[model samples]
Each structure stands twice: as C-alpha cells, then as structure tokens.
Target: MEDLSIQHVHLELSENLEAHRTQGFSNANALVVRRGAPFRVSVQLKGRPFNPTTDYLRIRVSLGRLYVLMPVTFSRRAPSSRWSAHIDPTTSNKQTLFISICAPASSPVGSYRVQLSVFTQDRQRSAANGSFILLCNPWCSEDEVYIPFEDQREEYVQSDSGLLFKGTPMNLVSRPWSFDQYEPGVLEACLNLLQVSPQHKRNRTKDYRNRCDPVYISRVVSAMINCEDDRGVLKGNWSNDYKQGVSPSKWTGSGDILKQWAQSGFSPVKYGQCWVFAAVMCTVMRVLGVPCRVVSNFNSAHDTNDNLVIEEYYSETGQKMNLSKDSIWNFHVWVECWMSRRDLGSEMDGWQVLDPTPQERSGGVFCCGPAPVKAIRSRRIDLLYDVPFVYAEVNADVHTIILGQGQVVGFSKDTEKVGSLICTKAVGFPRLQNITGDYKFIKGPTSTISSMSSTMSEDSTTSRGSSKGVLVSLSLDKSPVAGEPIRFMVKVMNKQSVTKRLKVHVNAQAKEYNHSPSDTFWENHAVLQLAPMEVTVLRNQILPAQFEHVDEDILINLAAVLEDMSSHERFLASEEFNITSPELIVQVAEESIVPNKDHAATVSFTNPFPHPVSGVLTVTGAGLIHGKTQFRMSTLRPGGRIEQNVTFNPSMAGVKMLQASLSLSDRNIVIRGFTMVHINRV
Candidate 1:
C-alpha cells in the first residue's frame, strides 16, 4: 500500500550537512511519507569520500510508537557521493521494519510524523529528519471493525474443555502452561498444593495432556455454581457463631463461608492474583463462621500476564510456571452473603472479597505489615488501648474525647459533666462563684458630719431637743420637655449617721425619633452632679429637637443618672413627654371689600387660636391681580388679628362682582364673601 504523506517533519540531527556540501546540494532537507509504504531516502555525508573501511553509518526511525534502527554499510568506493537506502517491501525487511500498531480500528484517521536519524559510530555524530500520515478506509463500518463482544454472543466457550464461558476464562487457557484447575479435595488439595510444592502445582497446566485434579476442577466449578438450596449456607443471623453453633452442615460450601464473612463485617481486598486470595479468604472466613460464596469467571487486569510474568519461576521438574500470580485462571472471584436483619441493607451486606497477601509491601493491618492503630483516647477519660490493660487515668469532667494519637472511630452513649464556667472578667478582677451578703461602713473622726433639724412647737413649755432621723426629699416641678429646659430641686438632711461626701449626678438620655413626631426634640446630654444634703434648683436647660414633617406626633423624653460621690455608685431615672400641635385652626381676617376703582383694598384677619397662620389668598369674580396673594402670620397671640389689601382697576363695564377670601392654615376652615360694584369700562 502506498502512503499518503500528511504528517509534519521535525529535524533533530546534530551536524549541518547542507552548509558543508559544495556540489549544489543542500543537507538541510525535509521528507513526508505515509505509514506502511516502500520509499527511498537520500542524504549527503560530510567529509572525505571512500573511507568506508573504518567508518560506518546507520539510520534510526521513531514514529511515536514505532522505533526502527537500521545499519547501512556503504561501499568503500562511494563515500563522497549522496548516500541512499531503499526500504524493502517485506514485513521482515531489515532496513524497513513492519509496525503492526494495535490501536482501536475506530481511532480517528490522521497524520502522525516520526523522527529519522543518521549516525556514524566512529565520528560519534548524527543527523535526523521525518514525516508520516495515515489514511483510514472511508468504506469501513465502525461496527464491523469495533464490534462489542457483549452484542455478538451471550457467552463464550472454551474450545479445549468444551465448557461454556461468559467472561475471560478462555483468556487464561491461552497461557495453558501457567495455570489450571484441581479436582477432588479441591479446598484441601489447593491449599496443600499451594503450600507444599507451590512450583509443581503451578506447572500442572504446562501441558494440555496433563489431567488436572477433579477436586481442583470442582473448586473452579463451585465458583460458577449458585446456591439454590440454602441447605448449609447461612442465610441471615449474622451474629450467630457459625463455627460453634452452626456447623459446616449449615454451609453449602467454602463459597457459603465467604458469603457469611460479607454478612458480618468483611469486604474485598484486591491486588495481584486477587481471585486466588479471595478464594482462600472465603474458605478461611467460612471456617471463621462468616457465611460467604464465590463469584467466579470474572475478567480482571490483576490476573493478566503482567502479574504472572513478575511471579514466574522454575519447578524441580525444570518446567516454567507462574506461582500464585495466576491463582484463579482468567476468571475473577467474589463472595456474596445474606446479611442478618442487623446488617441487612447496611454497607456490610452484599458481595465482599477477603484481604489478600500484598503483591507489594504495605503499611497497614490485613496486609503483610504493621497495624495502623497507634493510640486511642476516650472522650470522657484518657484510656490507652495500645498498652496492656484498657484503663482510664485522667477523666475529663466534661464530655469530650481528646486523643494524643489516632482518631475517634466510635463513641459511647453517656455524659460526664453538666455545666462549664468561663472567665470573662479582666485579669485583675477576682474570680469567684455564688457570692451573697452585706458590708458595713465605718468613717474616721477626721470626716465631718453636718446636722440640720426642723422643729415644730405647740402651746406649752419649751420643747426638749429630740434626736430624730433626718428625712431628705427630692422632687421636680414637671418632667422636662424636649428642646425646653427642666427645673429640679433637691433637699438633704442628716439621718441616723451624718451622711457625708454625697453627690448626685444627673445624666439625661439624648434621643431622637424619626418619622414619628413624638420625642422629636430629645437630645443626649452630659452627666450632672449635686452636693450632699444640699438644696439646689436648676432650670432652663435647652435640649436638641429633631423634627420630621412626615409624622404628626411629637416625642419628648429625658433620662438622668444620679451617682453617690463617696462610693462612685450611680442610679438612673428617666422622664418622657410629647409636644404636638392640635389640628391647626386657621382663619382669614378680611372677607370682602368694596373699593373705588384704582384704590387699594385692605383685608384683616383675627386668629382666635394659639398657633401660627399661613395660607394663600385669591380674589375671584373680579379682575384682581393675575397671581394669587399669600400671607403668613407667626404663632399669633390668642385673639390676635392680621390684615392685608389688594387694589385693582375696573376696566370692564357693567356690574362687576368682587369676591375675596382668607386662606386658612386649616384646610377645613375658610372665611369668604363677595361684594358687587358698578364700574365703567376704561
């Protein structure tokens, strides 16, 4: 087949031949060729001609996967001229190697370039170039070239054994000399065969003529055999010890043993020749009371020649065979078990494989290595599990698991501590719990005592001085209004003991309200202080006022904190009130007026209420000014009046009507009247 050149060529040679050649020839050249084609390639060699006796040349080709090295022996006479090599047509042509790349036939057709090198051993020099392409058959059907085996046949059969196979059992037979089956005493025999003469038992299948033990064959057959009769197989009751209570009579076979193990707490472990280990593990688990069975004839990469090749060895008979690496023929094996109600539907149920000896060294339990369980600690107690006895030394009053090493895999259902106390106070503060009681106070003679007494006498002899406890009272005339000042008075006297070093601090809350008119005038204020037993009156303190037009309610609030000067302890008091304008009552002072043409007319208004008056005034029915007239009056004194006037020129003839009215601040109130006047048109 001719190649359709399509691949790119990359140069990787060391020497530049095109520069040294002088015969109108260039060494820097490129070539493109398709795979599987006979082609000729030529290149000029630098240096003297006809030195072939000692010098040798060779070509190397690398098409990604295909590598070919060809030695070229040029005639000793023709060294200076262009050297050429023709690839042979045959598959075994030394100069032209055949490459049967086994890629999926469905692989996309494209061009792939490879590198070509020319080297001289004596000179230790080399030069290289390459090109490549692949043309796929457009008429080829994908199904015809890459048909899936599942769609072709329900199952496959071994031609030599006449046994039906579904998966990869036949593939194992292809390497007949490496693996085989055992007949009667399959379990014990396979075990003995594996242990005593592992090499001999392994080579039993080297020759097709050798008869495999029926017992070993039976074991293989057992993998395919399903347990219809639950006779000896343990169905459920995973907690039951099959070894003691349920004897071997309860198990169908070694497969049943594996199934039991799965029901308990076992899972599959995979490695090289995993099936062999799985089978052995199933038998071991069955003997250990776990119900299990094997799933046979499964294809797995673990059973391939890669593993077998590494495990290959010679027997005493001088025959070659793979050891346990080819343990389970081509067929894979797994165990399925019927879990008890406790484990049913749990992760422990279903099919599981046993741990196998590691094909390579590992660092964990169940393998040929150390246990990973290093240390353990209890949540409520410090219990060391790795050491001899399980004892707890330091018990955590709190329900917590603290481990020095390892992790908490499980926990017990119990509590140890009820409550915990955290210290939040500053470092200098004393840490104490549950405090209660009262303290006594004493003063030195240096402290001065002030005494004031009030006396009341009836008609009689002079009243004797009576010792009585002094009563002090504090009171305010009214709660402070926001934006307005507050007046306060305090009275103090000597009680059982002369009260000394007493000071009152009044701190008012400065607050603001939005949207609501209530408390709109409250402002935050600083703290105020008062002397002991001192009568003091304070007034006219202005508070800030924040007003929002949206809400019609007024808000007023005040807060004060009183502190004892001696103890530095303080007490707080607050007062709140509201400031609101009653629904506004507005009226116009003047109603109507009859003024001579061109004379100014005046209007007057009387506000009988205590509020500011504001509105727009208009004159209709007559030719008044073009724009409207507006008036504003400050919060009028009760029964106050305001006046205004408008002068107009009567230009039209006939009887003209003059209507004038006062706009009231209240939308519901309007004082209006009309007046008629005879006018001549100007």
Candidate 2:
C-alpha cells in the first residue's frame, strides 16, 4: 500500500490561466486562477494504476485551519455550490492521472493550499502539496461578479488603460489614465489592501468567508480607498493644497501610487481627488477580478444634510457667496462595479455605484455603495450602503437665491442642473457613453430655470415659476480658450409692454472644478434703460490676465444680476466654463514600433501665456517607458516653441500611450497630451 503513492504533481499554469482569462496575472509567479472554473493538474503515480473500489484519491484545499476535502469521481455531474473534482478521461493513463478541480463560485478569494491524498483500505497518505491564488470570476454565470457581455467584461476587468472624463459637460475632457493593474507590485498591493483591512484584523475567519461575495469585497474596497477611517490607500484632498505630497492631478497611473503605498509600510498616499480616488479603486477592483468602470457625473451635488436640495446664494451684485454647506461640483467621478445583487433580487443585479471619495460617512465609515444602479433609478432610498447619499448626488434640486439686505430678493429652482449629464467610457472604444438614463428617468424639455419674486417663500417656489416681467438667458459665442479673452452675451428681454429701468451687474470669479468660486476677480455694474417690449443684449468680456495666475486647472463663473428699479425685482443668469489649455504634441518617428527596440519621440509645446514660462516637462507610459522622463526648461518668451527628444525601449508588444505634461513654474497649470503607439511583436 505504501508503494501506491504519488510521485510528482504538475500544475498546468499557462494553459489554466489562459482558460480562466487570467493571462495578465502570470507575473504573480503562482498558479493564479479564477473561482467557479476547473483547473487541471497531472498526478504521476509511483507504483501502479489506482483501483476505484479498493483505493481512492481525494483533493484537499485549505486556508489556515479551514479546509475542504473532495473525493475524485469518475462520473461527471452537474456543477454544484460545493467543491468538485473529476478525472479527465481523455488525458488519464496507467501511471499518470490527470485531475480537474473546481472551486465553487462562492469560494473565498485568496491563497489556498492544495494537497492530494491517496486512501488505501484503512489509511490515508498525503501524496503531493501545492498552492494557488483564487480570484473572483466574472466569466462564470454562477458568480456574483459575472458580466454577460464579453466586450464589457474585457474592457472593465482586463483593460489597463482608460479615460476619465472631467471638465464641464460642455467642455468635456477625456483624461487618459493608466489603471496599471498588470504593472509590477500593483496586484500584490491590491491583495495587500485586503490583508491590511480592518475586517481582516478584527476577525480573520469571518473576513475570509465573506470575501466570496463581491458586495462584501466592494464595500471593503470602497472604505479602503480613502484614509478617513482606516489606514487606507489614498488620502483625499479637495482644498487644492498639495504641499506635503504629490498633487492628485499629476498622477498618471495607479502603479506608482500603489507601489509607493506598499513600500511605505502601508502608509496612506497623500493627495487624491474624485477622479484619482475613482481611478485607483478601479485598478484595485480589476486586479481582484471584479468588473469595474469609472463614471463621471456632471454637475454632481453634495447634499451635506440629506435634504435633497443644494442652496446656493448670490449677492445682489451677482457675486456668488459661499453661504451654504451643500455645493455642486462641475464634475464628480466614481466607479461602478458590475455584480449580482442576490440580496436585492435579480432586478437590482447590474451596475452598482461604489464611490471611494470620502464625501460622506456611511455606517461611521467613509465608504459608499454596492448600491444597485437599478435601485437608484427606482428611487429606492431605503436600501443599505448609503444609497440615499448617492441618489442625492445625481438627482437633487438646486435652489439659487439672491440675498439683499438679509432678505431673499430673487429665487430660482433648477431641477435639471444638478445631474445634467452622466457618462462613462464606451466599451471596446475610446469615447464617452451617455449613462444618465441609468441613474434617473429622462424628463422632456422644460424650462430648467424658474425665477420667483422676493415675496415667494423658498418652500413655496416650484420648478415651473417664471420671472416677473423679464426673461434672461446667458450665451457664449465660442468655447473659452486659454490666453484669450472670454466673451459672452447676456440677453435680457422685457416681457411686459411697460418700459423698465434696471441695473445690470456682471461678476466673473475663478473657481476650482470641484469647489465654489473665489472672490470676484472682475465685475461690472451698469444702469440701463429698457424701452417698452425691448430686447437688449449685454456683452461682457473677462481678460486673460484676470485668471492666468489662478491656482490649478480652474473654471470661470460668469454671472449677471438684473434688478428692476420700478418693482425692485431682480433676476440672475450665469455660465460656468473651463478655459482650454494648450496641449503637448508627441510624435513618434518610427512607422512600426517593436518590443525592446529604441524609439525616438518628440514632445513639443509653445508658450501660450503672455509672459515667459519655465517648468518641468514629464512624460509617462505604463508599458512603453520604464519610468517617467522629465526635462526642466528655462523661461521661454511668449510664442516661443521648445521641442524635447525622448528615447525609450518598448518592454512588450501592445498599444501603449505616451503621455506628456508640462507643469508651469509660474502658475498652477498642467498642459497634457498623449499619442498612441501600436507595437508589433517580435
């Protein structure tokens, strides 16, 4: 009986990983496979062929003290929720037995030990020992993270490079991001995120068991992305003060951030905003085998008090005042992970919103969602995981009020402005896809702005009210460009037949994309006389010098306030716009890019500002370059052009992007550009 033992075991690592759609994780140097899928291992018998009646083979998989044993069977049966093992009839020989093992779809995702035991008449002998790392399976139908669409699964779970939509809806900027899940030490960092979690520290057994559900894992990831409550991955900063750490806008990929975090003994990496937090979380989720995508919500509201109304105040002179805790960002970025929600039933089993930004606390922790998108569309606010907070983000109402002498003079309610657009990167493409309908039902065209009199109470004003005897609208002739004056026209019409005397005050303020505006940088006040039933257009211009010295990439808020002298009624119209920055030009001279071959790329830019500018130019690529290549430049005169020649060797064959950014030394501005290079395999 001792002679009938196992000699050696061979794990078909390459073939199994390819079959499991996990070829990208081959760098882990372990048998990395997904759950709910069967992997094969060949066992060579030392003595003779096993007899089914007198001898039996069983497989043991264990994590710590918890273990499961499954007997090898010849008969094939339907898949079940338990561990299963069967012999591959076509590959079995007299001395070599090829066995297939399938861990349940609900198996815990982590490292597990595999042992083969041969049982003879009265004794069991441990024959071979091996190990594997299991991940969530989006390809398995029974798995909670299963996504039906092949293209979607590939884009969400496999693609390493993506685009994060920022700026305003009108001037959308598709910022390139390197998810970098396949980069060195990133996957290990993702696994480390789970190991260092509070749940794992509190109760190891329970944490391991709960990892089987994507919902549980997502909640953990959401909390782990922000350092508000735990020793998480990234520390969120919205104050535009990044003196102690790298600025969030300067991050090109998750690889450096994750590697830095792990190398620093799990210390929180400083300075992440909405997009940075969302992009980093996407990398972690994709590394863990969960399907995830970054989504941008334009005009996203932060309802601090959960009242579903964001109150914004403006002075009588059209200067925006920071009088309320609730505010609306130009755009807010978050992640949506695809999974099945058994707890909420199949109706709620599609895309789930998981925001990692520490905007609001949930259950005493700064994590959000696994809240089903369908549930949000249906207004199911009672669901768990901060659904109400997310619901208010994209569907809240904006109450704009004009305060004069401590009295509300003019008021308006904008129901459509809070969530004008919601989008994500398209599947299998490099463009934006509108997903606004997924969050809220589309409403037909209606007057988004409704103005009211000072006598109307805030609660009594509805979304259908109109201004008394006047109608106002703001319009821009063209998009605002950097180094050029921003010119816009404000049209105010007297609806009534009587003539009206009015005061027209226009205010221009510089603002961060995610926060309220600063003090009024440029404002104009004028008294105008409107003839009976007259239509007048007031033209305004904000010069380039007025905002070039502003901090960071910012937006300009242009607001106009009109007060009727006869009736003392005031109306407001405003436009928020982003000034387009100059882009860097990247040119690769070679026609065909090959791996391990030196390539010359040129990064060229001209001074777009009025004064001389000097800064450091940084170029980064995930798989194309080893690390970032930076060049410091002297002050170039206005309209002066500079070209930098960069040489790098391609590490592997794929489509890679070379991203370049020029951060000005004189001002807080970053000019970015990218060019895709498709490499040929050797």
Candidate 3:
C-alpha cells in the first residue's frame, strides 16, 4: 500500500478566467470565475498512483458556516444547478491528477475556500487548500440574470463607461459617466458594499444565501447606495449646498466614490443627486455581474400619498408655490436591471426597476425595487417591492391650480405631462433610446382647463369675451445659454369688443433641476391698454448679469400673468428652461486606437462670458487613461481660448469614452463634454 498523499494544488486561473469571460478581472491573485461554469484544478500526488475503488477524494467549498461537500467521482456529466466534481480521465497520470469543479448556477456569489481531502477506505489521509471568487453569471443560460443578446451583455456588464441623460426631453443632454467597474480597488469596493450592508451585518449566513438571487442583491444595493439608513456609499444633497464634501456634479466616475467610501472605513461619500445615485448603483450591479442601465423619466412625479395624483399650486401672478407635499421633478433617474422574477412569475420577468435614491422606504428599510417593468406597464400595483410607487411616478395625473386669497381661481388637469418621455442609452452607441413605450401606453394630449366664471356682470361683458375669456401663450425666442441673455416672448390676446385695462407681471426664478422653483431672480411689471380684438406681444430679455450669481445647471422658471383691471380675471403661462453651459471640445488625435498604444487628445475651452474666468480642468476615461489627470487653468480674458493636451495608453480593447469637466472658480459651475473612441484589440 502507498500513502497517496496530495502534495499541491494548482488553480488554472488564466484558462478558467478566459473561459468564464472574466479575463478583465484577472488582476487579482486569487482565481476569479463565474458561477454555473466548470474550472479546472490540478493535484500532484506524493507517493503512488491512486486507485479509484480504494483511495478517494472529497471537495469541500465553504463560505463561513455554509459549506457544501461533494465526493470526487469518475462521473463526467453536464453542469447544472448543483455542486459537482470529477477527475479528468484524459489528463490523469500516476503522479498527478486533473480535476474539474463546478459551482451551481444558484450558488451564493462571493469568495469561497476550496479544500480537497484525500481518504483511504473512508479514512482521511491528506488535504490541500485553495480559494476563488465567484460572481453572478450573465453569460450562462442557467443563471437567472442571464441575458441572451451578446451585444447587450457587453454593453451592460462589460463596458466600463456610459452616458446618463439629463436636462429636458426637448433639450436632451447626454452626461457621460464612467462605470469603472474594473478600475483598481473598484471591484473590491463593490464587494465591500455587500459586506457593510445591514442585512449582512445582521445575519451573515442568511445574507449570503439571499445573494444567490438578483432580486435580493438589487434590493440590498439599492439601500446601500444612500446613507440615510445604513453606512452606505453616498450621501444625498439636493439643497444646492455642498460645503462639507464634494458636490455630486463633480463626480464623473464611480471609482472615486467607491474607493473613498471604502478607505474611510465605510463612511458615506458626500453629496449625490438622482443621476449620481443611479450611476453608482449601475456600477455596483455591473461589477457583481448583473446587467444594468440607468434610465431617466422626464416630468417624473413623486406621489407622496399613493393617490396616483400630484397637486401643484401657483400664485395669482404665475409664480409656482410649494404648498403641496407632492412634487414633479423635471427628470428623475433610476436603474433597470435584467433578471428573472421567479417569485413574480415568468410573465413579470425582464427588466426590473431599482431606485437607489432614498425618496421612500420599503420593507422597513430605505430600499426600493426589483419591481418588474411589465407589472408597472400593466398597472399591476398589487405586486411586491414598491410597484405602486413606481407606477405613480410615471402614470400619475397632475392637477395644476391657482390660489387667490385661499380660494381656487384657476384649475387645469394635465394627463400627459407626467412621464412625457422615458429613455436610456442605446446599445453600442452614444445616443438616447426611447423606452417610453415600455412604461406606459401612448395617449392623445389631454390637457384641459375648466372654464372660469367672469368677475364682471353678464350685462357688462360682451358675448365674445365671456365665451373665450383671456388667452395667454408663452414662447422662447432662442435657446438660453450661459453668459448670454435669455430672450422670450409673451403673447396676450383680448377677444372682447371693448377696450380693457390690464396689468402684466413677469417672473423668473432659479430652481434646481429636480426641485421646485426657489426665490425669484428677475421680474417685471407693467400696465397695458388693449382695444377690442387686439393682440399684445411682449419681448423680454433677462441679461446674463442678472443670473450670473445663480447656480450652474439650474433651471429657470419664466412665467407671465395677465390681470384684467376691472374684471379681476387672471391668465397665466410659464416655461421651464435651463442655461446651457459652454462645452469643452475633446478631439482624439489618433485615427485608429489599439490596446496598449499611446494616444493623444486635446481639451479646449473658450471663454464665452464677458469677464475673466479661471477653473480646474479634469480629464478621465476608464480604459483610455490610467487614473484622472487634473490641471489648473490660468485666468483667460473675454473671448480667450485655452487648449490642454493629454496623452495616455489604452489598457483594454472596447468602445471607450473620454470625458472632461471644467470646474470654475468664484462660481458654482461645471462644464462637461465627452468624445467616444473605439479601441480595437491588439
């Protein structure tokens, strides 16, 4: 008889990672592989050839208290949702033996310790130890998060850079974001997010078990993105004040936020908005092997009472008031992840909405989602995981009212304003893909205003005036831009066959993109006299000096009100617009970009304001640059232009985006721009 003791075990990291499509994560020393796939390991014997009938082997995989032990046999079978092990007959010799191990597709994703125990006649003799990290499998058909399309998998799971749509639907702005899932310390930080979660802290075994499902994982990540409940990743700030920490707008990538959180001993990163929260959540999901994308809902409503309606109040002078708790954001961002809803049936399985912003609580925690998109489209609010909340966000009706002396003077119902548009980044492109049809059915415009009673007596008013009342319309003469005066026109028409004395009031207020209007920035008042059937067009311009002190990227609410001097009748029209910041020009000098080859690009900025301006220019790209490059730009006078050159080497092959942002001094403004580069494989 021979000892048949195991000498050493080798993990075929390169071969297994290549097969698992996780080659990008090979920077770690430990073996990294996706679940539901088989990985090879070789074992060397110390003494003699092992006979399968007498000498046996058992493989044990464990994470904390949860462990799975399986007998090594000659059974060469297809992999399934079960732990199995077998010796490779073709590679086994007298001194060394090759073995393949498979973790079930439903296995809990995390680091696992692999141990091989040798036995002779059921008695333990020798053992060997190894380790590997297991992640969710989007490429495996057996995985619940499996996506069939290759292009979509590459875009959602593999691509480290993306675009977040902001601004209004009429004027869409593609804000570039670096997912940076594979950046140094980013993947580790993503895993650390799970470790710091309240669920994992409460019960490690149960949390590990629940991670096998994408639904559980999404819910946990959603709550952990905000610091309201747990010591999460980012702190949300919508008050336009970021003195203590970095502003949410300054973040161009998730790598810095994640690393900051981890380095600070699980403290929350400062200042995040809706888009920032969604972008960071998308990065964590992608790093954990879940297909995810950020989505923007234009005119998204926050129905506080679950009534499927949002009430808005306005003053008699057309100024919007914050009297109601419910509000409508110009745009609200959230993430949609691809996974199967076994708990909600196959029909409900598909893209599910997971909002990371801490707007509301679910299941006694500040987490929301795993709500199926189909369920929301079907108006099935009875389902689990905050379906009614998301349903109201996109399908709620809006009631606009005007109050005078605590009485309703005017009222309008707009059925089409809420969720006018929904979109996400298109696959393999840097453009917007309209997904509005997925959330709701298209209906005809249904905005109607109730007839208001004339303040004048019937005998005093003409039939035409009583029938049509006063009609007011507002229009923008040109797109508003920073350092340029905003020009717009207000048209007021009188239909009565009588001379009328009227008072006109125009108000402009600066507001955050996701909140209600703040204090008025500019206003105008005038007295006008109109003859019978006469139209008045008032052209107005708000100079850059008037709003230069206002915050950057904030929307301007320009409203006009016409009051009948005698009748006391009021008509209101308002428009919400944003001042477009000057964009940087990023031109890649290389005609063809290949992996590991140096490339040069230029970042240019021209001062459009009349005064001198100085700022810091920061350039970053996930696969194109090593980290981020920052340069302090000197003060440039009016009409002065400056160009900074950047040179870097591409690390991987894929479609990469180079993004630049200029943060100005003496003002709160951030100008951003990006250009796409297709890097070919070396």
Model 3 clashing residue pairs (backbone): none
Worst 10 residues of 3 by lDDT: 450-459
Every model's TM-score:
0.17, 0.92, 0.94
Better of 1 and 2 by lDDT: 2
> Which residues of candidate 2, in runs, are more than 4 Å off?
1-8, 44-56, 94-96, 118-126, 445-468, 588-600, 646-655, 679-682
Model 1, residue 136: C-alpha shift (Å): 97
What's the lDDT for candidate 2? 0.85
How many steric clashes does model 3 contain?
A: 0
Could you tell me which 10 consecutive residues in candidate 2 have the lowest summed lDDT? 450-459
Q: lDDT for each of the candidates?
A: 0.27, 0.85, 0.86
Residue range 353-462, candidate 1, lDDT tens digits: 22232322212212211110111121211211111110011111111111112332111111111111101111111112110000011123311111111111111111
Give me candidate 1's TM-score against the actual structure.
Answer: 0.17
lDDT of prediction 3: 0.86
Cα RMSD, model 1? 43.9
Count of clashes, each model: 49, 0, 0
